[model samples]
Target: MPARNEAGNLPALVDEIAAALASRGPFEAIVVDDGSNDATPKVLAELKRTRPWLIPLRHAVSCGQSAAIRTGVRAATAPVVATLDGDGQNDPTFLPAALDALAAGGARVGLVAGQRLGRKDTGFKKIQSRIANAVRGRVLGDGTRDTGCGLKAFRRDVFLALPYFDALHRFLPALVRREGFEVGLIDVVDRPRQAGVSNYGLWDRLWVGILDLYGVWWLIRRRRQVPEVTEL
Candidate 1:
């Protein structure tokens, strides 16, 4: 998980996620610090010293969540990668279930996105998300209900193949679909924020999302399709 200034929530979030994954056996938790100005790096370093499973990476400057995600993905040593927001709003318990869905191989699904049920965001934020989701669904036709939900899992190879851009993290379903992979949706629990303020606002996301939507659309249209050759 890529975390930025998430010092207050990191301890609990890491602990809960670790405990949840313990039931399924070993899994490494890569915590990438996205140039956090707060004590996030200190906390991660301390944790890493004791917990070998907790790997830590730090960016010299603050990058957007998308960049942080790319860093973490590159550092991932596992076949399957799961991502969740650092704010602790996404439930870790649903991770194993998302992995199970991916393993089922329903139509070569490349990404499994968790749909946040009963979101706990402010009314304004929720309204903005609803509008954005409606627009994205109409434009992309990716069949994903909640692309904004942070909890997601997919094959590591599939994730590394996608083009990188700022805020492109929100369009994973559509991008993965363009690669001829199906997207699976699963319902996940949402929780109220326990610490720190949200990094996004309504107007900023709205304006940026509009531009990103068009950019993704053009990329999708211009994408080249090549047949896979098994034996020459």
Candidate 2:
């Protein structure tokens, strides 16, 4: 999970994820403490002692959510990786289903994006997301309704190969499709934050997200074609 100053939310969130994933199979929960100023580091440190499956990574300075995600993925030892928001809004209960979707989608499927069914955010946040999704769809044509949802599962290699950007997390569906892969979605019920304040501001990212959308559109247009070949 990518987190900045989310100490109030991390410990319980981690435990909840572990409990949810317990009966399913082996899973490690990695928390990327993205230069948090609070007691986040201390909390993670304590959790590590009890939850050995928990992997802790620290960034010297806050590099945004995208950077933190990239860092965690790079350090991930699993073939498939699952990402959750540090704020505990994205339900961990949906992770196993997402994993199943990836497996059932066959090898060509590179991503399983979680689409929030009934989002628990405020009216303003919901409207901003709706508008953003519409604009992004029209521009990039990624065919995903909710790319901003934090719950996602995908092959680690597929993510590592994609071009890195500050807001890459928001455009994952389009990027995954651009790499000759399919992206699947599963509906999930969103939850309100367990504690603390939200670090993200829709207005702060509105302009940058627009630019990123257009950049991705150009990328799709310029994407190179490869010919099928066999060894002679």
Candidate 3:
């Protein structure tokens, strides 16, 4: 999980995750604290002492959520990586199902993104997301409904191979497709923030994404289509 000052929500979210997937298999939680000014690091330390499966990684200064996720995925030993926001809005109850879906989809499926069914964001925030998603879908043709959903499961190697960027997380469906892999989708009921303030809002998110949308579109068009090779 990529966290920035999410101390208030971590404890309960951690417990929920443990309860949800403890029996499934050997799974680990890598909480990347992105230079939080709150008690996030200390809280992670305390949790680590008790939870062996919890891996706590920290950033000296905030490097944004995408960098934090990349750091955690790089440090992970698991074949598949699951990431959710640290603010407790992503319900841990849906993780096992996502893992199962990814597993069943087999190797060709590089990403299984959670589509938020009922968003709990403010009206303006939802509107911004709707506009963004509509534009992205029309441009990229990624066939994903809710790319903004934090709950996502993907192969570790696939994620590592994809081009990394500051806002790359929101473009996974398109990038994974660019890597010759199919994307899977699952519907998850959105939950309201359990605690702490939201780090994102309308204008801050919208303005930056306009350029990124076009950039991704360019990438799609410029891709070199590799022909099938047959060797003697």
Q: How far off is residue 200 in model 2, in Å?
A: 1.3
The 10-residue segment with the lowest total lDDT in model 3: 220-229
Residue 45 Cα positional deviation in candidate 3, in Å, after optimal superposition: 0.8
What local lDDT does model 1 show for residue 18?
92
Q: How big is the RMSD of model 1? A: 1.3
| Residue clash pairs of candidate 3 | none
lDDT for 78 in candidate 3 is 88
Angstrom error at residue 33, model 2: 0.3
- lDDT, candidate 3, residue 73? 95
* RMSD list, candidates in order: 1.3, 1.3, 1.4
Q: What number of clashing residue pairs does each candidate have, in the order they appear? A: 0, 0, 0
Residue runs of model 2 more than 4 Å from their true location after superposition: 226-232
After superposition, which runs of candidate 3 have C-alpha atoms over 4 Å from their true positions? Answer: 226-232
Q: Give the distance in Å from residue 175's predicted Cα in candidate 1 to where it truly belongs.
A: 0.3
66-179 in candidate 3: lDDT tens per residue?
A: 999999999999899999999988999999889999999997899999999889999988888888889899999999978999999999999998888889999999999998
Tens digits of per-residue lDDT for model 2, 36-146: 999999999999997889999999999999999999999999999999899989988898999899999987899999999989999999998999999999888889999
lDDT of 1 at 30: 89
